[model samples]
Target: MGTYKQQSHVVWQCNYHIVLCPKYRFRVLTGLVKDLVEHDIKMLCQWKDCEVEELSVQPDHIHLLVSIPPKVSISELMGLLKGKLAIKLFKSYPQLKQKPYWGNHFWSRGYFVNTIGLNEDMIRRYVLHQEEEDKKEETNGKHFTLFD
Candidate 1:
C-alpha cells in the first residue's frame, strides 16, 4: 500500500540497492571525474525512467538506491549505464584510458545488487491480521465483497 508507479498495464514499486566499483578499484573517481559521473548517472537514470532514491559516489566505488520499472531488467540497466558511462568518460577525458584502464573498460566486471522492500515483520503482521478479519467475516455469515 505504499507509493507505487503505474504504467499502461502495471503498477510496481521495485527498488534496488546497487554497488559498483571502478575497474581495479582505482581512486580515479575524484575532482571533475566525480562530478561528471554523478551528473551522467542522474541523466541516464532519468532516461530509463528510474528514480534515484539515493546515490553516493566515492573515490573507489559508488552506492546507488534506485527504483526501477519492471519493464527494464536490472542487468540491462547496469549494462547500459556502465558501458555508456565509460565511453562518455573516456571521450571526455582521454587520460582515463591510460595505465590500468587501457583495456577500455571503466567499471568492474561485477557489481552487488539487493532488492529493497517493506520490513518483513510488518508484512507478516498484516497477513496475520487479515486472516483474523476473514475469520470474523465467515462467522458473521458474510463473504468478503470487493465493492462493499
Candidate 2:
C-alpha cells in the first residue's frame, strides 16, 4: 500500500450562495428570510460548530462565508444550515409548510460553494458581486435554472 498522506488542521473556508425560484421571488423570499431568520441566521453561522465569517442576505439568495473544521464536511454543514432553519421555520409558520419548499426540501438542492485557496479578497468579491449580477440578470428577464 502507498504511504498515507498526513493531515493537518485544515481550516475549510468557503463561500456559499444559492437562489430561489422566480415565482417565489415575487413572494419576496429575501424579506421573509430576514424576518423569519433574523436571529436564527446568527445561530446558523455556528452550525456544526463552524465559525461564520460573514453573512449577507440578498433578494433571492443568501451569502454565507464560514470556516468549517475538518471534523465536518461541507455538505454536512449545508445540511445543518438548511435543516435547522427549515425545521424551525416550518414549525413556526404554517405557510412554508406548503409543497416544493426549495425543491422538496428547506433549501434549494444545488448551491454554489467556493473553496478558498488564495487571494481571499477575490473570492469575497465574487460572492458579494453575485448578488448584484443575479439581480441584474433577473431584471433583464434572463431565465433562471430549471429549478426556477
Candidate 3:
C-alpha cells in the first residue's frame, strides 16, 4: 500500500501529476526566472499544506508531482498557484510585463492534471477478498438475530 496521510478523521493519499505552460508557450523560463518559479511553487504548495514530490521547470512548460490533502481541491490549488506565481513573477521582474505577456498573465489558461494511485487490479483483488471473508463469517455458526 502507498504511504497515507491522516487528518483528524480521515486518511488519504491523493497525488497528482500536473503540467503547466507559459502564456502563448513562451520559452522565457530560464536562469533567474526558472529559479523564482520553482521557489514560488514550493512556497505555494507548502502554504496549502501540500507536499511537492517532484518539480521540473522547463523553458515553456513545467511538470509538478504533488501530494495534496483531501481538504484541498485540485482546481483551487492550481488557481492559487498560477495566480500567485504570475503576480509574484511580474512584480519581481518587471521586464516580463512587456511583449507577449501584455495581458498581465503568465501561465496559460488551462493546465493538465492526472491522478496517481495503485493499479486497478490490486484494488479489485482486495475488494473481492474482503467480500469472500464476509461470506465466510455469515456462514459460520455464531449468527445472532435481534428477534432472538
**Candidate number with greatest lDDT:** 3
Please give, for residues 1-148, the per-residue lDDT of candidate 1 as tens digits.
Answer: 2588899999899999999999889998999999999998999999999999999999999999999999989999999889999999999999888875656888899999999989989999999899898899889978966776
Q: Name the 10 consecutive residues with the lowest summed lDDT in model 3.
A: 139-148
What stretches of model 1 exceed 4 Å from their correct place? 125-133, 144-148
lDDT sort, best first: 3, 1, 2
- Stronger candidate by lDDT (1 vs 3): 3
C-alpha local distance difference test of each model: 0.91, 0.60, 0.92
How does each model score on TM-score?
A: 0.86, 0.56, 0.86
- Between prediction 1 and prediction 2, which has the larger lDDT? 1
Give a tens-digit lDDT track for model 2, residues 28-141: 356665667656766775646666666666656667666665677777776666778777766776566566444335555566777644567987999999999999998998
Candidate 2, TM-score vs. the true structure? 0.56
Residue pairs that clash (backbone atoms under 3 angstroms), model 1: none
Report the lDDT of model 2 for residue 61.
66
Give the per-residue lDDT of model 3 (tens digit) for 20-132.
Answer: 99989999899999999999999999999999999999999999999999999999999999999999898999988997565698899899999999988988998989888
